[model samples]
Target: MDTLTLQSTIRMNNGVEIPRFGLGTFQSKAGEETYNAVRWALEMGYRHIDTAALYGNEEDVGRAIADSGIPREEIFLVTKVWNDDQGYESTLRALEASLRHLKTDYVDLYLIHWPVKGLRHETWKAMVEIYKQGKARAVGVSNYTIRHLEELLSNTELVPAANQIEFSPFLYRKALLEYCVQHGIVVEAYSPLARAQKLEDPRLTAMAQKYGKTPAQIALRWALQHDLVVIPKSVRKERILENASIFDFELSAEDMAEMDTWNEDYWTISESYNPECSPRWE
Candidate 1:
């Protein structure tokens, strides 16, 4: 963990290398806000950028990358197929639309944004096809639970290269993380800081003081130390810089265990929107 830098990457199952830390553009607005945020992140040495068709910022993200003057292959770009576009044919069409918006012929990684009930299997089939055709270097899923993963594995010969999930000290998903690891699927953590909902907690703040870092850094560092790829979102230049300045320190083993106790199954997304709680997942 001490040797990790902003440039460090984890190799996916398909031999694609993904930067372990990245910028998340979930709620980042579609225009200049998303564009500048991505530009700042790239300037700060972030090579991976996570966006989606649902985010409505792929063009902004693409423009920022193109304008950054960085070679396209140097940046590990990721985008997702939204729930509404989950069928096999529509999934293929969705990636094409996303590519047109991102202004790229291929994505470093492509994901099914959600496990849209009854459509996820077909969606996975399309994802496999995309991967085979080189449209995506690797294909995976997001917001998937253990059951969903089990169902996917049981039905498909190809294992997902990664699984993006909402993970943090405040929403520790130990079982899910372990399950992914056992299956050789990398876990990418979104909302790694729990959307700042618990950043002000006394325990987290105290740890931040102990490490001379911000609570957000502590949370992101924890995720990194756990070997999870973490993408924390921020639009402000200062915050973007702050989020990337997490590699200089390491949390003690005792403190890591203490933070693990902070989990309450908390979620920033409402119950109706939380994928874990959706009846469709059953």
Candidate 2:
């Protein structure tokens, strides 16, 4: 197995380098909570931070980055355009709003938060424009299924550089991961630890003991071994430090295979909201 590190990165189809491990600021609140989280993550050597317009914490994220004094060029900042903001003109405007909130001239990565059926194609057009103009180092999609990706591919010449999804051993989505890999789209796992819902499962706990790591670490290591980018969310200082400690060990192939079997289509996000089953993507 290849060695990995806290600062390791994966190159996108467009040749932009994205850190393999990142901090996900999904439900992290605005103000002090979100601010401290990003600050702590950066202090601990994290170079990537994922947020979205819908997260309502972009200002705080940007504030933390600015205060870190780590040189903006060193951090891979990412934000998304929300559902209501899906359209050619609106999407373009959304990026501007995000840039303003993020207090940066441009984002390292900008993504379509969700595939809003009729509007997603036009949104991609805006994403292409954003890339061409250099406002985003790379453009990608989040919560996109194979059908959604195929439709965008059929219509546009620009392939997304990454695809963010609620992925973990419990919700493996093997076919989706394989398709992303085959097409050179990096798969980024958002809820890599399954939102702590399955952290106590005997199987996972046993594996954790075997590796002398926490269940969260085992889950994150599993994702890393599969070559997927992981952005496990946490606001606490200890958890932020703990999440980045997966670099010291690698899971054995047999254990990896066993974890793969643990997939039951479990999702930290509700199934109704899952891109595969969501009517919003139809």
Which portions of model 2 miss their true places by more than 4 Å? none
Model 1 CA deviation exceeding 4 Å by range: none
What does candidate 1 score in Cα RMSD to the true structure? 0.9
Please state the error at residue 98 of candidate 2 in Å: 0.5
Cand. 1 Cα-lDDT: 0.94
lDDT of each residue in 113-184, candidate 2, tens digit only: 999988999999999999999999999999999999998888989999999998999999999999999999
Quote model 2's TM-score.
0.99
Whole-model lDDT values for every prediction = 0.94, 0.94
Whole-model alpha-carbon lDDT for candidate 2: 0.94
Give the CA lDDT, 0 to 100, for residue 55 in model 1.
96
